[model samples]
Target: MKFGNDRNSSRFRLPPSTAYRQAMRYDDKTLVVVGGSSGLGLATARAFTAGGGRVVIGGRSVERLEQAREVLGDAARTAVIDTGDTASVTRFFEAIEPIDYLFTPAASYTIAPFDHPDEAALASPFDGKFWGQVRCVRAAAPKLARDGAVVLMSGAASARPPKGAALYAAANGAVEAFGRGLAVDLAPVRVNVIAPGTIDGDLWRRRPAQVRAAAFAGQAAGSLVGRPGSEDEIAQAVLFLLTNGFTTGATLFADGGYSLR
Candidate 1:
């Protein structure tokens, strides 16, 4: 969506930031991304591989996993995992050893107003995103390295719920809280949350063009920055959480200040 008729939105591009420019050296490290087949997770996986880290990418789709492996090449290993299924999570971790970092962003759910009749729709966010991450962490605990970290995916909805997104917002809030509590529980193995704003990425691209445009415009108008964020930007933020030893029990809002407004 255009910022406005009078203003040139293209001029509002993000300035060069040190976060994306800084060198990340993860030569011998390994990253486990539960949703690494596409979008933000895929971006992070690519960045980690570029930093010389080995990645184990898990997703529900075998075809997508194979596609991701093609993009990541020998630096990555692919597996099928459905976070909503406990046994699937267990098997995904069992196949990989000594994980240096973990990021879970795979979730499938609906977001609608409270008046929606389908009970399953209301519960899907928690089932897919909140509890899904919980199951993965529980299963990965044994394989997680003491020096490693866990980064969970959350959304700006947790802070500011737009109309018809109350449950979605609540689920995201739960994930943020889960990250804090899990951080303490995991101890030396850090746990953090990346609550990103509306990103113009693969996820949104699947939606109708008109709907996608409207969502992007609305998100841009709400944020301090007058633009939607990129998958790569969120990817860099996740990497920061993964590599930073001092940070834990924290939720980093990479939402262009959407919550503030």
Candidate 2:
């Protein structure tokens, strides 16, 4: 909710007060959002569009892509990109022109306990998120603007995990570590990761209404801020990572102190 951050405008952009007043407009920027059909990715796309940026959302579902396109209107476009598939990823990036930013919030994982976990099961989360990110980066790197950046999605669970979530935690850990290494590898392209705490997003909508409400309440109470995070809050963190030229190889947490709790 706080818009006083430096990403709105930098300190060198005339008076300090003017920076706060300036809207965070992307104008000429082209942002490609993978997994953007819904949830955090879609929210991020909306933020960039509001800032006057052109956005192309990527996902596998034609129906979902159309839904996103309908909601995002003319300022946004959608592509059927299955980031977990090598051929799909290669084709997706191949068809696109150069872009200024890449935001990947795509993820899925099994919830089974770690007791006697199968090798195939162990690999599922990694294949889905960890390697998917790797392939997306590899495919998108050449097309990315030299001065532009990429924002990878990680979770607070990567650092602090509850029971039945170890695999997910590990996968997210790989993403953060990979992002730092990628930032080093890519140099001036500026790669960073966002380790968000639990937010009330589309993923939560799958549960029954009362269950979802109770779960949100529980998570909110556990956080120091006494509330669940909004998707827009996480989107702001994504925007910060993309706009702040000085930041790179950093994992920014917007978890409302959930990690502390």
Candidate 3:
């Protein structure tokens, strides 16, 4: 069930009025999405392209990016970027044109107990999720359109830290703060954060079956909605942040009311 990707596909057709609204929502706009090869990033890229927005997807995996290019069709382009490396991120942005919007979900780090014996493991979240996003935004700042918007990915764990996720919580909290401060410092270039809850997506699907089941069950029990979120749901929230002119420095918790619990 490909949605909004194949324009002629009959399985997921939009109504006339809805189609009209989507036709040119992002016409002449170019969006750069780091970590867009899979999961939430890929879903957002597809949605943007469907709205007539040109998307430049950046990721560390060549094979995954190629796969995403197929899903996005001609409306999107792919680039290689290692968010953990400042030089790779700089080069990735340097090769691209001015961006009308930017959304970064790329991070490579481990989440562990605060009392974990390995010091590096304890510091991994800040190095990857926190600093990695900061680097990408810094590189893309000069190339961003004055009216453009930026959406940084956070997680519901920031607000409601569950067992064994204290470090992860702290990292997400930092991202939210950074989004607020960056919104002010970047002025006219809207900056926002999206803190999503547990999602039934690629990340979870790849885990061991028992582990995945246990995690999902716990997540369902913890959230107000009693279920995990979908990638498309989070993508919609991201689009709203990018297009809403009056929204900036706001943290949208698209967590199925998880944070409220």
User: What lDDT score belongs to each candidate, Candidate 1 first?
Assistant: 0.92, 0.87, 0.92
* Model 2: per-residue Cα lDDT at residue 128: 84
Span of ten consecutive residues with least summed lDDT in model 1: 2-11
RMSD of each: 7.9, 5.0, 7.6
Compose the digit string of candidate 1's lDDT tens values, residues 127-164: 98999999999999988899999999999889888889
Best-performing candidate as measured by TM-score: 1
lDDT of 2: 0.87
Which is the better candidate, 1 or 2, if ranked by TM-score? 1
Candidate 3's C-alpha runs over 4 A off are 1-24, 259-261
Model 2, range 90-117, lDDT digits (tens) per residue?
A: 9989888898999988766565456645
lDDT of 3 by residue, 23-132 (tens): 54788999999999999999999889888899999999899999999999999999999988999999999999999999999988888999999989988999989999
Q: Which of the two, 2 or 3, has more TM-score?
A: 3
lDDT of 2 at 126: 85
Better of 2 and 3 by lDDT: 3
Off by over 4 Å in 1: 1-22, 259-261
TM-score each candidate: 0.91, 0.89, 0.90
